[model samples]
Target: TSNAEKELPDAFLRRCVFHFIEFPEKDLMARIVRVHHPDLDQKLLDQTLQAFYSLRDIDGLRKRPSTSELIDWIAVLRRAGIASVELEAGMPFLGALLKREQDLLVFAEA
Candidate 1:
């Protein structure tokens, strides 16, 4: 649950049971996305997931977006009627996925 494991005290760490969860692969993520957005267009979902994963790959990101953020970003896109074609040019509603200013700036520069 913590991003800063080094900051925790030894006593606190000793009492905790840590389990690392790997980020979902594309197929698993697509299935997860469908659960929240069953009727979403296939092309849009594919493109969105691609962009999301690409964002996560960016180096020096202070806070990479999570599944929750991806869901939120897709929600905004759906509400805004964003088409898959638009995503090819640039990601819309990026703020939903990237909360940190530094992260956003890094993405922009990339």
Candidate 2:
């Protein structure tokens, strides 16, 4: 109580509220992908998600691609008739996943 009083004024604290949100699970993410691309082959969906998650794990990305970005990327892949969802195959269509030039360059150099 003393620490809280010392660090924060009562007036300021009165306006604050806490909420918890659990990270979306893999199954949820998969469902998001499916919703965006219902006609996408199951194997391709799985492979693309694996690659997308792998990209998120890379260090120093200015911004990691979101599930929405993944959907767009998959759409791009389908439009280009890319069957395999490997890193190399998806490289050309990276614009869908990464919106910033720095992020794209960082990924390219990585």
Candidate 3:
């Protein structure tokens, strides 16, 4: 199941690169969503994200999601915008991959 989830994203990125899309950094948030709600709908995530931005200022920093610290990820991605769908996925996935303060840098690096 986990592998399937991972591959869905891997395939999307490979396709993006093939098509010459400029994948952005926002995709990182998807990682956080996968951790809490692996089956979370991309559409609902989109809605949650829209709600996120609609509630805040364009240049303002979000206070973070109320559901979980992990959900703070949704904020990170929203701030980055939609061009980075792949990076959105990476946020939660990599967040899980690197929990330590030291590894945090690695997660960002990845």
Number of the top-ranking candidate, with TM-score as the measure: 1
Tens-place lDDT digits, model 1, residues 20-81: 99889999999999999999999999999999999999998988899999999999998998
For each candidate, what TM-score against the reference?
Answer: 0.89, 0.72, 0.30
The per-model lDDT (C-alpha) reads 0.90, 0.77, 0.45
Using TM-score as the yardstick, the better of models 2 and 3 is 2
Worst 10 residues of 1 by lDDT: 1-10
Per-residue lDDT of model 2, residues 1-110, tens digit only: 21322577778769877556564567788888888788888888787878888788889887788878888898988998887645455565888888889888888887
lDDT of 2: 0.77
What's the candidate order when arranged by decreasing TM-score?
Answer: 1, 2, 3
Give the per-residue lDDT digits (tens) of candidate 3, residues 30-59: 565667656555775865545433323223
Residue pairs with colliding backbones in model 1 are: none
Cα RMSDs, all models: 1.7, 7.1, 14.4
Error of 3 at 65 (Å): 4.6
- Predicted structure 2, TM vs. truth: 0.72
lDDT (Cα, 0-100) at 93 in candidate 3: 37
